[model samples]
Target: MQAPERIMSCERPDSEEFCYFLAKDYFRFVLDGSESQPAANNVVETLRRSGSSLDRSGRELEHCINKLNLSSIEEVERVLPSLMREIYSDGIDNWGRIVTLYAFCGVLVSNLKKKGVPERELIEGVAQCLAQYTWTHKAAWIKENGGWEKGFVEHFQEKKNSHFYTKIAAFTGIVAAFSFVIYQH
Candidate 1:
């Protein structure tokens, strides 16, 4: 985290394709901004298990949700923040909880859509929240952490972050399939 050489602009992220990939790949399911949105119950379980699949943090979050018998969108909605806050505090080398956090958020947003929440609301709300997160809460941390150029590229490197993986070809194509999150447009 040696200051990333240079911090990047939040508007035009240095590691932009990572955001595009998240939108195209990981978040492709809910990318439909169409008018006729599905009701919460009508939505399938495609993202239901996403949170619990990545790592232990996800499992623990799932456990707490289960233990509380929090099955509904309303129920999990109430308590998930506290549980996630705990996980965020743990940090664990920054990369440990990175993908897990996105999976958890993606699960919740997808569920909200299923529960009849409008896509616009979910979309705008996430955008606003990300703005605050990057500019407000973690601005200093993100700056010192090298912003996306170093953070996104280094953290989600495919196989290994060799010189080969440092170029746009590797950054955009290979690593994108199974890696990356956190910095999204």
Candidate 2:
């Protein structure tokens, strides 16, 4: 079967986008466990100090994910390698940076939603943005907390055609490949 759709597609702010955004945020923080409250707090403090004027509490979330070294949808495609290395370090074998970027996109969409923007449109925007980086090096990412299969299945249930689903599938594949490679050593 087709593994599933990747989340990069849902980076757009179209209809049904919120479903993906919420699912993305849910997976990163709740499932992936890379997002901590301290990171959220750092984001809030940074925005407040920088006077970014982003009013939603979700902005803190956005800031935190970005700080984790995830790229913003606005980032150019060429800069991803450096960005990924900065976040994942030598574990570049595991596409942790890319995963974090997807997670960050989810947060950005949610932030827009909290700021009174239409959830669907914001989510679609996120998906569209992700579609750009849809082909980042295809490396495996560390499982850190949980396995990708369980997380992807739980996060992308009936939403099979969505960007979130696609991302989960791709993420799972990447992580699985990495695990296989490590096992061979």
Candidate 3:
């Protein structure tokens, strides 16, 4: 199958509102992140079955998560590398580094979960790698790239140093939820 298209627009994933929306709507009860394809479909079906009983916010959130959920793991896996490339893109003055990094963090979390790995270990490892990469190596790239400041400024304005750390917390929640759903089956 053809690779899924990348999200070309640059947006930060640091918003608590966005994270909460993702947490409640997208990753809420993912019992089997590894069985992501079927599990995602099931979750979407569950949401669809719930239908208009949902409020406007609930419906919108459900729809967004449904979009993320319906995509196959094979498709997600195929696009992972390309997503990484965009994170490390050259010459484009891309300010979406942190946003891309956060998204990649989510994908990596999902990938590891789907691999049937331990939830804590998977999320912790990826979060550490991301922190190290951003502070050491990626920091240099940001200094050279003009677009970095915009992303950083916008990302931190909401909650100071919390965004980076908060992502890991959010990821852990999703992974834990995935594990819980798996154990229930």
Candidate 4:
């Protein structure tokens, strides 16, 4: 069991190869409550601004998730894939979109956690779902883009224009909102 799970997790290889673990770990960083959640924290720290601070981003993210109105796991299952399809409708070329996907997963986990989904079940289920997305939708892209290695990291942090912050704002909103939603339920 653990062996299969370790397979699902992203481990750095000696060579540049596509690894699904990067996506799972990014999601798990939230689901498993790991102390270092660089996906969210890094973006939040980079885009820290008044009225759009980390705390505020969470509240705003809560508002965005509320707009989705996902009250049940069934609804989450039915709707999230569709939302994901729409989210990646263009392409996963930019860091903002990738972060938005991260934010989206964060929102779903928050929903599940709020609805009292068991922790082990939630982690396994979400990891599997993300793994599906990893192999199906984004594997080639991850391989081409840098597989969370120098390529992805370099692109992710380079804030070249003002529009980047807008994306950061949206992503942060999703990240910060989870805890509030989780506790409320």
Each candidate: what lDDT? 0.38, 0.36, 0.37, 0.50
- Clashes per model (N, Cα, C within 3 A): 4, 26, 3, 5
Winning model by lDDT:
4
Model 3: per-residue Cα lDDT over 48-165, one tens digit each:
2221112211233233223344234444344433434443443332333344344434544554576665565554454444444454445555555432334444434544445445
CA shift of 168, model 2, Å:
21
Residue 15 local lDDT, model 1: 36
Tens-digit lDDT track for model 2 on 12-63? 3222332343333343343223334332222222212221211121244344
How well does candidate 1 score on lDDT at residue 104? 45
Tell me the lDDT of candidate 3: 0.37
Per-prediction TM-score to the true structure, in the order listed:
0.45, 0.32, 0.33, 0.61
By the TM-score metric, which is better: model 2 or model 4?
4
Candidate 4's residue-wise lDDT over 36-126, tens digit each?
5443322233322211223334455556577666655566666656555555554535545555555556656766687787655655555
* Residue-level error in angstroms, candidate 1, position 92: 5.1
Q: How far does residue 133 in candidate 3 sit from its true spot (Å)?
A: 1.5
The digit string of per-residue lDDT tens for model 1 on 99-134 reads: 444554454555556667666566445433433333
Q: Which candidate wins on TM-score? A: 4
Model 4 residue 136 lDDT? 74
Measured on C-alpha atoms, candidate 4 has an lDDT of: 0.50
Pairs of colliding residues, candidate 4: 9-21, 10-21, 58-176, 58-177, 61-173
